[model samples]
Target: MNVAPNNHKTGKEADTASVANYRVDNFTRLVTYSPRFLLMLLILPVLSGLVSVLLPAFGWAPALEQTRFGVQGFMALWQTPGLTQMIGLSVTSGFISTLLAFLMTLMILAAFFNSVWLNRIERLFSPILVIPHAAAAIAVGFLIAPSGMFSRLISPWLSNWELAPQGILPHDAYGISIILGLTLKEMPFLLLMALGVLAQPELGKKLRQQHKVALNLGYYPMTAFFKVVLPNLYPLLRLPLFAILAYASASVEIPLILGPNTPPTLAVAIVQWFNDVDLNLRIKASAGAVLQLVLTAGLLVLWLAGEKLVKVLCNNSITNGRRKYHDKVWQTATIGLTIVILGFVLLALIGLFLWSVAGYWRFPATLPEQFVLLHFQNSFMQMSTPLFNTLTIGFITTLFAITLTLLCLESEQLTTKAISPFTHLIIYLPLIVPSIAFLFGLVWLQQLLNNQTAFLNVAFTHLLFVLPYTFLSLSSSYRRLDPRFANVAASLGATPSKIFFQVKLPQLFAPILIAVALGLAVSFGQYLPTLLAGGGRIATITTEAVTLANGASRRTSAVYAMIQMVLPLIGFALAWILPKYWFKGAKA
Candidate 1:
């Protein structure tokens, strides 16, 4: 009996031990994998936005007011007379801009599908994508302002009547100018992202094959693109579309320049509240920010729902007899509108260039009365320090982002099972959420950490923005790389580090360079974060450009805008050139 009892106890204990060991092994794997997992979890920078917006919305901000908390702030926000109109402006502008951009992108893609003009058009679109949004807005403002280039060009020739030299175009009570500006800035981004999506090898091959088959069946290219390619492309394009929608809804600077004073967009209103001399208004600003967030989030959800509906419709149509309609009207409209968009972009650039050199070129002058480099000369002298600071920050941020992205890619590759969606989410957190909302909380944190170095903090803040894009650009390339070479090299007794440096790095040098360049561009374009994190001590080209743009001197603003455009162009050029030099003999 004693032996039986002992054996039973031992068996039970062995089973328990086995269970405990399995738990321990699982915990060990989780703990070991937690860093990369945590990286993914960082996607909810939305939480930062909630914290920043909610506290202030509830009147809990110690910096602004001593009000403990109450419904008063929320009520105050609602009761504000122009609040409804402001919300209307934001929603309308955002939706319209995104809608126009989406249609234009679709049209452009449809029109140029597998044509000779496709390459040329894509090449032309590249520079437009690289131009910073704020700079583009400023350029558009210059081009359309009464005293701007358009007025100057047509003033003398038409009816011998001078351009009014005072009224704003499409910038009346409706905020249409804001919509136009945002569309102009966002369309190229959509196109570029579309290009990236279209470049996927499998998708491209499939699309090409489908196009050939459709063409052989006597289908028009546009019809084939719409019927065959759009369904595949839309899914890939969804994220960028969401990004545009969010941006349009929360945009501040563009509306500030072009939106009506009687009732600005929600973003502008929030900015005003934050900047209000009255401390009590900060609560209202917080409330406004919360409202803006809710509105944008709601739109995003709606967009996703619509996408699902469209997918279902498309899939169902495949099973049913869906008549293929070649809408030449749509094709004509798309081609015409795209030409106009391209024209405006070119006009904006030309207008900016002219303004940079214009001495006395005011309204009614077809050409500058006197062309001199004085504005550039003066602006460059004043902006030299800020330019240097921008470059330094951009370089450091890009370097860190590239290194982090490489590590992330390596981690993903080494570990299987999708490496956690959270990692990718975290990388993209900064893009979806509004910067201003989070920067407020970040400011509070900065104040708490009073002893920390400003430069380090600013760089860290920039990393939060740059890392996602760098990782995204590099991830696809990294995953596509063949492991056979590495395996062979390892079999030949090459060290891991040696193989990585000699083989992997050489193979990925071009993409890595492009990723770094993109990171540099993103960092350079940052405005809100730099201002908030630097404690107003560090000046960057973006900060200066915004400040100068707010000033009365169009000439000075033009100079800053040019610099903003030029820096990224230089980075892109370097990104292009370095790989060619470094991997001259290597087969792609």
Candidate 2:
């Protein structure tokens, strides 16, 4: 009787274990087949940061002893002296910069959409994508400053001057310098985005053929491009356009270096208030942050309105059936202007290189009279710690971000449900939102959580910022991957894990490296996150460059800026070369 009862209990326990194992396997399948949980995890930080800003905008920062909610912060913010001028500067620079970038992008596509010029333009512009916005701004500043290389080269030859002509080139009063600086930096990004849009297989060949058909129907090249191709293109470009608008409106480092002092751009002013020694100004800064969001939204609305106006204008041109306008002239004009822009960028970077080694260099001389390694040696020693910290943070954040993105994308592949538009918005939220509005809140959250590891804290913050870009960079190749490769592996009885590691990952190695390089660039370019999360206890090449720009030591600043350029270049080079070598060896 005892043996019979024991056997019965053992059978019952075995059944229970079997059920538990089934449940566990089912849960694993559910997670692997959906990205719902991952989406929530990614969106949580963005939501938290918004809430943190919203409360303080109403004067409710309890830590600062202002526990009450009111509109005092907003009142103070609007009442700031020269507030209207500041808003105008922000709007004008943002608008003009975005408009120019958009028009230039359209013209390039119109004129050179499928030609050799287009191919060469893309190849040349690819490297510009890796140049950080801050570095580009610094480079432009060096090139255009009153005492800068351009003036130095022209001096005594064309113009007789022993001293730099002040109030002439950079940091001018009307913010033209800022506008120009922003346009140069933004053009490459918009062009890159346009290339991606135009390069889509469905759009690529079909659109070119459509343009040719329209041209054959008595439409000019620019006219045909507008009537035949651009309507399809604009819809795709809307999000990236909004991103540029937001960035130009809330830009900090660029405006700081190139904007006016008497009334700096609104973003710069807000940063100043946030960093003010008086704790009460933090509320003002918060109010300003909210205003920045509103300002960016307003600019986007205006752009949308302009789109409607352009539609009407283009409709008139397209239907009027007049075919004799000089499309070649427009093409030539755009090409010349683009060449000028590229020339400026090249000269600017070369100016930085020249300045870094310059010693006892006086005004009115094109080349340095004396060159030395002193700046490099000194910068090397001073930046060693920060350099290591930057590398460590970049490595940690990129590794985790790439892994997370891969998992989410892989889940999408496994599921029938496609990643939704709302999910794309989640990925773009960090880029759309100004860093000032939420980064401080992030700093507060970090302190509250007692996350004292500065490196980890900063790396995590960077991961949030970097993940969206990494996903964008990699998602295209990932989603478009040929399913037949996996199908073949499965036919050979390969498990899902083995197929992923052995087949998909190897095939995607190039895009993976490219995504990593993009992430590394994005992290290196971060300023506000590093400043707030690291609590000024950490420094990187970017922060050092921006800080050094405030001082008059051009040599020191150049050294830091050049160093910032090098790390990303190495990443880009590897991304470019590795795949070729790997495939070459595979054939061998």
Candidate 3:
């Protein structure tokens, strides 16, 4: 009788194990092939956009009733005034800004790689990242403008001038101001990427060991980092550097604000062409878009060549076997640059706040004569619609992006297979390609498809940009999570889905929130995508701010820019605060 009962119990246990295995296998099969399909979905739009633009460049657009393909568009593009100057400006500004940001990133790492100062700088990254590019450009312009805050602070005491000085600071011919603005924005990104790499436990330990070995050999700390650690670190940074180069080369917003007007950068000029009342200019604009694409690619190629040159040049120093050199000057300079760059950003933001409330403020006064909410009150009625649209799009775009990213990452974990290198490149396509190039084409294609301008279309376009950033933000934390927790849960009869939701998701709450904030920021900063995708029907704070920035009303523009800056900051704050409160409640 006892033998019979024991046998029945064993049979029941076996059945349970079999069912669990079946569920796990079913889940694995479902997600295994999803990535390939998702990759196609992501790539098709970019390819279609490129094709749509290509036909117009050849003077063939059926919508325009000119099906004959020829070189008319290219010829018109070449004939445009200041064409050469626009291309030259784009190339120079892109290269100079990227180079400066990269060097500064290295200097900061060398000076305070594992120190408290480094930690402090890292803390400031969130605020800087939250500030939209348009807002930042406006703030930077105000702070550095000839009669702006910096000048007012030093005028009577040092310069002895009462009236605002006439100087072409922000809109200088060579685009110096554009470069400064780009550098301030790009450094945080590059530094963040580097820090992520350094934060990997195994890699960080190895780097520490290598750093120590070099120091023991009598090499100075800074020199040791360049010779030993940089070779490893730089390869990982190559993709981000390329992405930065692409943006700096063809960016429309900063250039629109700070670039010369006689002939803006190629990208900016293309926008003007597309927006012109003369419809024939659309074909020319298409050609310019194609040229801008080629220009950005050429810039990347040149950057690659520069990379080789730098490697060879640095290799000579490594061979010299120099043990010690005076690094104090270099360290001091690094610290000073860090302070100036951070100070400039802080003061620029403050300048925006002051301008928003100033009443009859003059050039030589650091403070407004009398602060008032008159500007805000005047702008509120106009600002209401754009603010609603911005929030709606930002939330919708972020939600979908986070969901898709989670699926992709979860699929990776389930299959125990990472995406191939080629697939990874495809995901980064939206970022590496200049938005002006494909977006210009996409706008025309949307018209051809009779796709109405709506929030869904705008959100979809925003997803193309937002998804990559979201994945990058959350992937590291997700992948590094311990497997034991899942194993233990599975042993308790949990299904794959259950472990994913209850076991894994809870552990990843903070990172998920962070990714959400990053997605919102990326969406909020989009200017061209929103304007083009929505066919000018959609007005986000970014688009409105950019428009107002170019207008004569500084106070009204400040009001819009301030709103743009605040939305992302609010997202980041929620990400930080929610986790603490939720976990505290759980503990209680």
Candidate 4:
């Protein structure tokens, strides 16, 4: 009887082991395949979108009844008036703005590394990072236009003029305004990306140690950062740098607001062509879209060349090992410039708020005549539907984006394999490719399949952009979560799913929520995706704000812009507040 009992116990144990092994194998398979699925999901749409544009560029659009393939679209695009100027403006504004933003970012990092100044900068610039491009453009317009707040602040005092200046301040001939606006918006992004990378505990410690070594070796702080830190740092930042370059090259909203009208940047011109009344312009627009892709790619190539040249030129200076290369003067200048740039952003925001509440404000006045809620009161009703749509889209997009990001991160843990570089590129494709190029084609595909699902369609499109940011925001923290927690959970007989939900997730709650806020911010800022994918069937705060911004109603535009700006701020606030309360109960 004892022998029988022992055999039965052994059989039961074997069965249990078999079941556990099966589960483990299954989970591993799922995890291993998840990245592949993500890559397919991201790549296929981009390819289809590209193909959709390509067909029309070659004159093959059945919707327009031109089914034959030819180069007429390209010919038409070539012959467009002031085409050369458009190209030149796009190249100049894109390249110069990106270069300026990048240089400013490097300067700030070199000047303030491992100091309280760096922390102060991080705190200040974080909020600016959330402001939508369209809203920022509007803010910049209010701040810098001839009749803008800055001009008024200086009028009849510094310059002795009672009236607004007549020269082109915003829509200047050389596209300087576009460059300034883009730089204001982009520099914060590069700063944040660099900061995030440096915030990694291990990497930051190593970098700090290296800096100390450089200091001991008689290198100036800035020069040490350049010689020791930047060489290592720049490679890590290559992807984000490329993203900034691509965005600066082909962004539509800022250029639309501030670029020259005679020959706007090729991006704005392409948008105009697409929206033109004549259907023939659609084909030409497709061709222009292709050209936009080419132009952006060319800009990237130029930037790469510049990188090589800079490396060659700096090689000697780097090796010379000077103790002090005017470090204090350089630091003060960079710090001053950083404050000025951030101050411009802050003043721009204040300008938006001031305009929203101003009543009968006149020129040369520092403050408004009266701060009234009339604009808000009058515009509240108009804002209702768009606000609702914005919230809905942002929530839906954020939820799915967070879910997908968490899943991808969890899968990495389960499989013990990091995503490959190719997969990384796929994730970044949306950011690096000019949205104007493929989004139109994607919209066309959506129309053919079923445009009636505008809400879902728009959310999905937002996901394309939002997911990348979401993943990037959350991945570092997710990966950095101590593995021992999971190991302990596993030892305690928790299933992978259970451990993921109970242990890993609770620990990652703060970062996940921050990622949620960032995803929402990204969704709220989307203009082309929402506009193109929604097919004008659905309106969001972004669309409404952009529309008002383009119109003559600055006050109304400010109201919409304020609402747009506030939504993301609200998301961030909740992200901050919820974590404190959420864990308080758990801790108790």
The model with the greatest lDDT is: 4
- Which parts of model 2 have CA positions greater than 4 angstroms off? 1-34
> How many clashes (backbone N, Cα, C below 3 Å) per candidate?
3, 0, 0, 0
TM-score of each: 0.87, 0.93, 0.95, 0.96
lDDT of each: 0.76, 0.83, 0.87, 0.88
Model 2 lDDT at residue 27: 43
* TM-score of model number 4: 0.96
Candidate 3 local lDDT, 11-130, one digit each (tens): 788998888788878766656766776687579878888888888989998878889999999999999889999999999999899999999999999988657778788888658877
Q: 3 or 4, which is superior by lDDT? A: 4
lDDT of 3 at 274: 88
Query: Candidate 4: which stretches are off by over 4 Å?
Result: 1-30
The candidate 2 region of ten consecutive residues with least summed lDDT is 1-10
Per residue, candidate 4 scores C-alpha lDDT tens digits across 89-187 of: 988998899889999999999999878889898889999889999899999999989889888878888988788888577888799999999998899
Candidate 4 residue-wise lDDT at 373: 91
lDDT of 2 by residue, 86-163 (tens): 899999999899889888888887888657888798888777778777777788889888888888888977878788
Screening candidate 1 with a backbone cut-off below 3 angstroms (N, C-alpha, C), the clashing residue pairs are 40-422, 40-423, 43-426
Task: Enumerate residue pairs that collide in model 2.
Answer: none
